[model samples]
Target: MKTIPVQLKSKDYDILIGRGLRAQIGTEVAKVWSKRKIALVSDKNVAELYLKEVHQSLEDAGFDVLDLVVPAGESSKSLAQMGDLVQQMADAGFTRADGVLALGGGVVGDLAGFTAASYMRGIAFIQVATSLTAQVDSSVGGKTAVNLKEVKNIIGAFYQPDLVLVDPDFLDTLSDRDLVEGYGEVVKTSVLHGQDFFALTGKIKSVQDIREQAEELSIHSIRYKAKIVMADEKESGQRQFLNFGHTFGHAIELLSHGSLRHGEAVSIGMVMISQRFEAVGITEKGLTDEIAQRLAAVGLPIDSDLVGTPLFFKHIVNDKKNRGGILNLVAVKNVGEPVIVAKALDDMHDFV
Candidate 1:
């Protein structure tokens, strides 16, 4: 097991990366949260898989435990679901002193964290990520949100978790499609933190290879994101670097009407961004090709069906980083290097 510390402005937490850590949550986390009641929030899929063991562990620790299950998928991360979960917490007699245990993938973590942050002001959150995407990226950062009617994560907050418990063993139960879907995040993170690219790329020859490398790559991606989020806790400036492939990624998600997986859209978006970087002469020769080749090698689509650059650009403008009509576009100077460029929606004609 490897441990990484995430130091935020108001709180500091640790991300525990290994197999079978879920079973040890009681022993490992009891000291830090001995007094607070534990609210176990997970999706129906995960609740079926491991919720009982998780619930028993917390109960055995003598902490008041409330287990709440939500539907699985992106739709679960919404204001309506958030409202329902908060009511569940309230019905369970939760207090501000209590903390939330997000026990599933990214969607669960985002919605649970959002609920914890908004309920009675705010509370601590613990991430027990069961999906590769959540464990590697979304579960580590303080960025918590529920999707709005017209946008992805349109309504959200920055509430750091108290601890992140990653159990790689969960990957064993993940469908091949979900595992493949998460590889997109791994590849995106690897591109930004290039030192791991070779190792990450070599671990998988095809989509079928995801299971073997999912755990290691997930840890690597989380550590990469942690380095950036820790440096800029509030996203005041530099943390935007973590949005390297997210600008177009979010747009793709929006354009697909939620049909696309977050990482799938991100994989396609990264390719488009790389191409745009090359077209603008911001990228080194052949680097864009390498990006596409690597993504394709793992079954992620490099080309997008989102034609009509103007329409796609419209969705880009809807990003959270857009301030005063300027979208903070995360582009790459090279594989593993991220630079933020502030551009108006109209200025994206050539790129999008």
Candidate 2:
């Protein structure tokens, strides 16, 4: 087992990563959180496979488990679904003393975490990350939110989890596409960390490689994020590095209208922004090709035809990074070096 501690001033927590950690969920959770009644939130797809095992584990640990399953997809992260979940928890007699346990992927984690953060003001939240995306990225970060029609993760909170269990065991059942989709964030982290991780990520060629190296790669991404989160918990300054590919990535995602996965979108965004920035001399020459080559090596695309979508500009301006009139864009100078470049929202159309 590998333990990485995220030492926030008030909400410090540990992220436990290992192969068989899923089976030890209940026991592991009991060590940090003492809540008696907990809501086990999952999606329909995941519930059919590992829900019973996880639920049984929680029950064995003396938890009054409330199994809350929702539809599985990006759509689940919505105001309607969040309201329904809050009402259900209220109907179940939940209190601030209780907690929430997210059992599926990012959707479940985001929804459950947000619900826990808002339930009677706040409650403990734990993450049992199932997907590679969740385990490697979303599971470790305290950022939680649902979508707002066109915008993604627009309404959310920075609520840290009490504990996060990232067991590679749960990754066994993911589809090939689902697994590869996660490499987008991996590639993003690699670029942010510089040469060491950049070279390491380039070695991942298949799901077999990812499975074999999950623990190591997960730790790399978590440590990078945890360090940045601890320094700039509310994204005042230093934390913007984490949004390296996300400005255009999120815009591309909104424009695709769910056609592309989040990671895929980010992959294209990373390369696109790098390509455009490198052309303008903001990013180092050859950096775009390097990023594109690594992403393509792992089967992630570096470009998308949706870049021409008329709604593209609109989505870009709506991003959270666009504070006041300046868009805080993350651009690359070299491998492992990312810089934030502020651009006027009105002047964005010609930058592409």
Candidate 3:
């Protein structure tokens, strides 16, 4: 197993990447926590697939495990679901000493992390990320949130997980669409890391390729994010670079009404934003086409019919990345160099 450390001073933790790490979660958690009540949180879909083994492992390791499963989807990342989770934990008499084990993908990680962050002020949590999105992005950054009705991830906190366990074997069970959506993140990270990493992604033509290189790719992505989070944990500065495609991507997601997956929308968002950057002389002339070709090669959508709709503009205005009527847009100068541009929200219309 390869381990990447997210150095956050007192909040430091390790991301363990390998195949079959799920079976060792109990022992892993035991290393940091001992003889405590534990809550194992997962979504119905993930629970149906791997809950039995996870529960058994924790129970066998002497943890008093409590099961909490939510419905699977973006909708579950809402205030209502978060409140219900808090109520369940309260009803079970859990305290700060008892931690939460997030046992699914991004949705589960966000909900469970937020639940742990809110319950009794804050409690520790571990991330057992099953989805590629969570493994590479959401599970490591200490950014947890539930979506508001009008926007995504508007209500949340910077609650770091005690441990992050990634088992690439889980990818073998994902549907092709689910698996393809994950490549969006991989592509995003690769581009931000620079041209060489971006070129490496060009070789991935299928989910089989992603699975075969999961450990290496995951570590590279995690290490990139870890270094950024450590430098600017609160996103006040350099960390905003991570939002490269997220601003437009989130707006697209809101407009889709669940029709577009986050990564797919971001795939389109990265392409659209790259074109915008090129138009303004921030990126090279052909950077947009290069990004589109890379996205299409991996089965991700490069353009969408909703590109210039009023609904799209409406959601973009509501994005949290905006401050004082200006959006801090992340633009790429090249494969690995991203710049933050402060543009008036009204000016965003020209990009569309």
Best by lDDT: 2
For residue 139, model 2's alpha carbon misses the true position, in angstroms, by: 1.0
lDDT of 1 by residue, 1-352 (tens): 8899988668788988988788888777786786668889999999999999999888888777888999888889889999998888888888888989999988999999999899999977888889888878889878899988768898989998888888878988898667777778877777778855645665577865777666778777877789988888878777887777778888887788867888888888878887877787887778767767777887777777784456677777678888988888777787677788778766777546
Backbone atom clashes (below 3 Å) for every candidate: 0, 1, 1
How high is the CA lDDT of each candidate model?
A: 0.82, 0.88, 0.88
Q: Lowest-lDDT window of 10 residues in candidate 2?
A: 305-314
Ranking by lDDT: 2, 3, 1
Off by over 4 Å in 2: none
In model 3, what are the clashing residue pairs, if there are any? 194-336
User: Which ten-residue region of model 3 has the weakest summed lDDT?
Assistant: 194-203
Candidate 2 residue lDDT tens string, 190-215: 99997999899878877678878878
TM-score of 3: 0.98
Give model 3's clash tally.
1
Global fold similarity of model 1 (TM-score): 0.95
